[model samples]
Target: MDTSTWIGIFSVSASAMCMGIGSIAPALSEGKALQQALSSIAQQPDEAGTISRTLFIGLAMIESIAIYCLVVAIVLIFANPFWNHVIAKPGG
Candidate 1:
């Protein structure tokens, strides 16, 4: 019922939402991107190398969004900025 308790609750819930929603979107995007890349490579065998290279770069960029979400979730769960604000109160 206290400030810290509320902070902990909110932080955990927020982290859960961040990870749950964030991971799904990127995973779907990566899957779609890979599928299209494969289709392109299959259609143009001679350009397989370039297509593969570009796919890797695109995948990395898309994956970065997931990585960022992970960082945010980790921070919310383990090192939430709001925790400091609540804990530093004079009567906390």
Candidate 2:
């Protein structure tokens, strides 16, 4: 295969891997966060509001990691800088 084909294959494989691996951590973290939040709420019913609010903020922050990975994967598959380099090269 040529360079362009190689880049295409790499891009697709990388994107798939990124998304597959990326989602797992967030899923786990979200589950764990929810579990801890619920535990805290159970332990301190009076502070449930604070604990829940902080949990939401923390979850949102953690979720941003997955979102960033998704954006990177999309860029790799659809807007790779290597594509420009490959296309611009002379004589294949």
Candidate 3:
């Protein structure tokens, strides 16, 4: 295949790999955060509201990492900067 085709394949493969692997840490972090929050709540029932609120905010922050990864993957697969360079070549 040509360079562009190979680039496309590689981009898609890398994007898929990024999304598949990038999500793991955030998932684990969110799970762990929730676990700790629950444990804290159990230990201090009166502070449940504060713990729950902090947990949700922390979860949202953690989730943003995955969202960023997804954005990067989408950009790689659908709007790759290399594609522009390849397409802009005089002989392309």
Q: Over the stretch 1-92, how does candidate 2's per-residue lDDT look in tens digits?
A: 88999998899999999999999999999999999999989999999989989998999999999999999999998889998789889975
Misplaced by over 4 Å in model 3 are: 88-91
Error of 3 at 27 (Å): 0.7
Per-residue lDDT for 1-92 in model 1, tens only?
A: 99899888999998999999999999999999999999999899999999999999999999999999999999997778899788788877
Q: Candidate 2, which segments miss by more than 4 Å at Cα?
A: 90-92
Q: Against the unseen true structure, what C-alpha lDDT does each candidate score?
A: 0.94, 0.93, 0.94
Candidate 2 RMSD computed on C-alpha atoms after optimal superposition onto the true structure = 1.6
Backbone steric clashes in candidate 2, count: 0
What does the lDDT read for residue 6 in candidate 1? 89
Count of steric clashes across candidates, in order: 0, 0, 0
What TM-score would each prediction reach against the true structure? 0.87, 0.87, 0.87
* Local distance difference test, candidate 1: 0.94
